[model samples]
Target: MSAKTNKGGAQAPLLGSKIKLHIEKLAIGGAGVARHEGVVVFVPQAAPNEEVLVEVSLVKKNYMEATLLEVLKPSPARREPPCPVASVCGGCNWQHITEIEQRKQKEQLVLETLKKFNPTLQFEYLPLKESPRSFRYRNRIQPKFKNNHFGFFARNSHDIVEITDCLITEEALTTKFSEVKIWAQGKNSKDLQRLEMYISEEGSVRYGLITDEDDGIGFSQVNRFQNEDLVQTALTWAGEDDYPHVLDLYAGAGNFTFPFAHKFKNAEITGVELNPKLVEKAKSKIKEKRMKYFLSDVESYMRRAVIGPEDLVVLDPPRAGASEYIMRALAAARPKRIIYISCHPVSLARDLNWIFAWSQKLGTPMKLARVQAFEMFPQTDHVETIAELRVDS
Candidate 1:
């Protein structure tokens, strides 16, 4: 074999070898993408546009993973992470990067993911929406309790990283950490008990255990500051067009459903959710006779419902995105407009691809009208995106 050739007659780098790489950009999981010997290397905690010295941690047939050892050159977007435990904790992955760069990366990633799925697609991509607050903005947080260790899980491990304060959490919630710690320590149960703390809509701070019988706040917007802008944007994009009904799928306590109902007073507002608790909550607030909340999965609801061409569908699904059946059904039904609020870009792109492909097959091609990324989550790789799809121009 030649000096640089492997047993398979292909060039491959030795594992545990130290190599210099120029980080071209950040990857989906908060890693820096660099190329070495025509193979991509993903280095954790590295910045884009920087030359970094990395140690090969793991090698694969096609790609390799590495650990950042030293920065030969730093990117302009690099910044000092404020969190003391950011490097060790799993709560955040992008805190070391600048806020401006974080949004830029998120925007680029969203578009890239979409393009990867729909190569020939073109849509009006809007400028990214920045979060109202970058730090101390999260109103809800879950701190673990095990042997009096009150904090989040460590990076790639179950071991709890003890923390008295979380930088992303609200000051009010952080102030209650001592009281919560004491409460957790007082518990006789030695097993780990997950705890929840959040500021309620009534302006009261509430804390409780996440029991098997009750899932504490299954889904919610951590950053309420940005949620206002998100809600307003969704409502505005939905527009004042009169439709027969406004259908909301995966509606958690009528977050967007109620707002859409409020705007379109003449249309029947129907919210479908699998979670019984959220459906109950949404039903309880039924002041309007036209508003209705159904306790069923989106797929199940769509199976029976006859979605008209004039109906407006607003779906805010989980990170997994809507199921394939739901997407295909929506494509066949061809609703007038679809406002999709997504948490994971890859899942969103996959779902969109399914819908568009199916619509094209059905001879009713729904076009992607607009898309915008929201910095709902700051100091982390997580991002929220809003996309609008319509049947006609």
Candidate 2:
């Protein structure tokens, strides 16, 4: 099924004859899930249980992409998005969806991913942790400059969209946008590649200009309000039992390590990171303590890591997930408990499968103790998840 172009001259390829469909669920990427003529059609900005009139935008062999032309029936969980450019900005995917609904959806996604990866594993979904402040929670934002104005590119597109205020950014940052814009215009603004802003939990604001001259923008948590909460939650999971040794992998600027040091005063905490600049900064921030900072690839550190039964490990890997060599090292260490924090569910699932396989081979199984998802980025398809695994005695 295809539709003829109207006066607008926008050529949209229709994939199905059915114009109206009831969305049954949400795809992993935050698109509305529906079937037209037995083919899956994904419509953006359409929530689950919503009856929408979709315009077929792109058609593929197995699935179709669509634009929500009209919402015949809105879901009860829908809310008015705060950001004017929320729809255009690719940073957020669930802005229109209510916060409660967003949490629920993320929880479901985590559980489903775990089930797919480990079929025999049984664990209860932990209560979703809510960020103390949802809106204006982001401490760091890297807005790009284009055409002599400060703005951010649409998700997956280089085309810039000028932004006056960002809903996810701190109020102080949003208010200072004009100041930053003016500063950029005066300097060799064209030479400026990216603007990175960081607002601490105490409301301290710092900005970094990514350019050819200086490459050091210390590692900082993107979401301000959630950062503290996430740190506290992780510390709780890394209990202060007989285990006095803690390993913090991917420890950027000591965000987790700095706080963990204070939380577990008697424990020996080590942070391993690849960035030398970050390691130096982390060392400066964490003073007069048993904390150790190493500048090396996480996999390399893990390979040389020797852990005893009284140690607990925390792995906060990037979107690519932990490497296979690191996974094997973790298996060898056999920590009493391991905390895995990930931004990509697919990679998390893959690593979990590898861990499960290793445990099965060793005949000492590791069980998923608990799993929870946090909505760090609203109005986008991205999710931040944390999973706890304990080795069965």
Candidate 3:
């Protein structure tokens, strides 16, 4: 069977099928995996060791997709979801699981992904960092506006849900949501598509218009509490410097670079971002002595420019992982230290594989010094990870 099939055209496996299968693990997108007759079925909202009765949504040659219908037996890690709209809204995935259990699950996923890529790799399970505030911690949120209502879209569907308050966003944003909703209700303008809320490091709130041409949604971290933890953790790993030359790749609006400049007064910090408007904003915010901002993709800058060995590179790439070209260029540059912050652990593992591969080709392998996970999105399956690698001297 092909992966693509018209919905309702084919009758999927029935919901009451007494398939007593043990869930072995979780897929990257938070689906539970269970094998039956050598066929793997992906079930959402399921946990390891769960026995569920699911209705197959799609059947492919190798695997099947299912929506959980009945939980015959629940896993010990499972917990009641706090948000009423958790299952309906696609914003969060692991809300049904306990916070500590969620962290463990994410950590396991990271380790499993790494092991899959590098069979010989072995590392200690670093304790996952808990967010200072689990709920209402997000500093930035992109709420979609559609169907004459303002709210987040249902998971995997375009149907907009009317949300009274988002449990994960800061109280201020949730409080301001009513105003936006009222404005959207009255206005019939087609110009506004989505609203992005940004709360800066100094606790300043700003709103941005997400448009087709540009995303000034800038580099502000999503989870406010975790963002602080991540920044401090990254800076600590960056180490004390007399005057270290810092290269911030994919640096959106100087989120890290601006604050980092104050810590290292004599350091030369260069921030590179793709958005011109954000770059301009970052430049304006620069009152420090040794900081520069550039509006260019990291790959283009690395391929054409000359980098010194004394420089330290900080990369916070998108979820799709860093481009191969950029990875190769960074390997060639051989910076003293590379602090990589990623939202998607799977992509981070993939990019780390490339970095390690390229470094080995250069005859100087980089050491994976530290790996830290942050609960940026509580009540969800998503996790933010930061990995630090140093060039083996």
Candidate 4:
């Protein structure tokens, strides 16, 4: 295969070249990172401290991507993946590595990424929180169905990887796989069938095709067991401050909103979510006059939000993370406490940088009190982090 540089319009001679590498560590995206000829090479399914043979696939100006040819020397954490389709499936990437190693790598990844973005930033780094169940913990999944195939997309490709069951998914959802396939067969469409299967809030398995008009049930924590602990951690970190107001930004179906309402009964709890369905779900459960749910994007809400020095803000933004304007607004508002729940570390680190930069500029400094990484999605590189921030008074 011919390799081409992503920039500079130059031909990459390393394309299709075979080389031996000692993987030093895993990168942010779960790729084993190694340096070859002074350029970083990223190989998927590689374990740290392992000697491996790889074939270079894509070459960029400063780095190259490779396919793992063979593991010459494997790390002790390396193990056989529990899933039969793990080799081809795109769902869980770190199944080849032991769970302990996965947690260790994840903890290191979060700390290193944060420090990389904010060099002098210091806060209490808590130990990684373990998931209640490493396997069978995923409560929701979006599987693809096409040409009688039912499974997830192939690694870096749109092609489907057929699988009878997913190891990372809970039994409640996995047991309905056959039934979902039968239901998909009734669709009778030749185009690639995109489907969503999840254990609903009612504890029943639900499945359906994803259409352009709708994005399915929307964002909710996939690991039910881990979510309980995550919610408690956020509440605990936020503390029992007698703030007059509480804000749950990016609130979905009142996951944290209702809990915050219960914890701070006197505080007026407000939730802002763009999805009308989630907003409706949240509003329907409102029991007190102090609770309010709005259907608006967080950036717009932050623009009009009346934040004060003693208010607590709990924001669980999506993977893309919150915007700069919102971060600047929060820094200016200088809430007494802010609990940020992030699923992506790079974005989280970037957002924190924004907050600190704005805080310094506005002369209302905010300090990171403590941060903890949660193993929300085990057998995958995805991690959930909760951070507490306080006004530097």
lDDT of 4 by residue, 1-393 (tens): 334344665438778888899899998888999988668899999999999999999877778899999999998889999888887888989999999999999999999999999999989999999999999998889999999998899988999999888988988888889989888889898888889888888888888888999789988889989999999888898787899999999999989998889999899999999999899888888989999899999998988999999999999999999999999999999999999999999999999999999999999889999999999999889999999999887
- RMSD of candidates 1 onward, in order: 1.9, 4.5, 4.1, 2.4
Superposed model 2: Cα runs more than 4 Å off: 1-18, 59-61, 188-192, 200-203, 212-218
Model 3's alpha-carbon lDDT is: 0.78
Clash pairs for candidate 1:
none
Question: lDDT at 214 for candidate 4?
Answer: 77
lDDT of each residue in 1-393, candidate 2, tens digit only? 434444653333454444888898777889988987676889889887889998787776667888888899999887788878888887777888888787777777877887888777777678767767778877678887766868898866887788888887788899888888777776674453588777754777777688667664756677766766777778888777766888899998787877777777777999999878889888887675688999989988776787877788888888899976777677767888999988888899889888877876777778888888876776566778888888876
What would the TM-score be for candidate 1 when compared with the true structure? 0.96
For each candidate in turn, the TM-score is 0.96, 0.89, 0.89, 0.96
Q: For candidate 4, give the lDDT of residue 385.
A: 93
lDDT of 1 by residue, 1-393 (tens): 112547874435457788899999988888999988778889989988998988888877778898999999999988889999999999999998999999999999999999999888889999999998999999999889898789999988889999989999999899999999888888878998899999988978899899889789767778999999999999999988998999999999999998898899999999999888888888999998899889998888988988999999999999889988999999999999999999999999999999998998999999999999999989988989999999854
Which regions of candidate 4 deviate over 4 angstroms? 1-11
Per-residue error for 220 in candidate 1, Å, reads 1.3
Off by over 4 Å in 1: 1-13
For model 3, where is the 10-residue window of minimal lDDT? 1-10
Steric clash count of candidate 1: 0
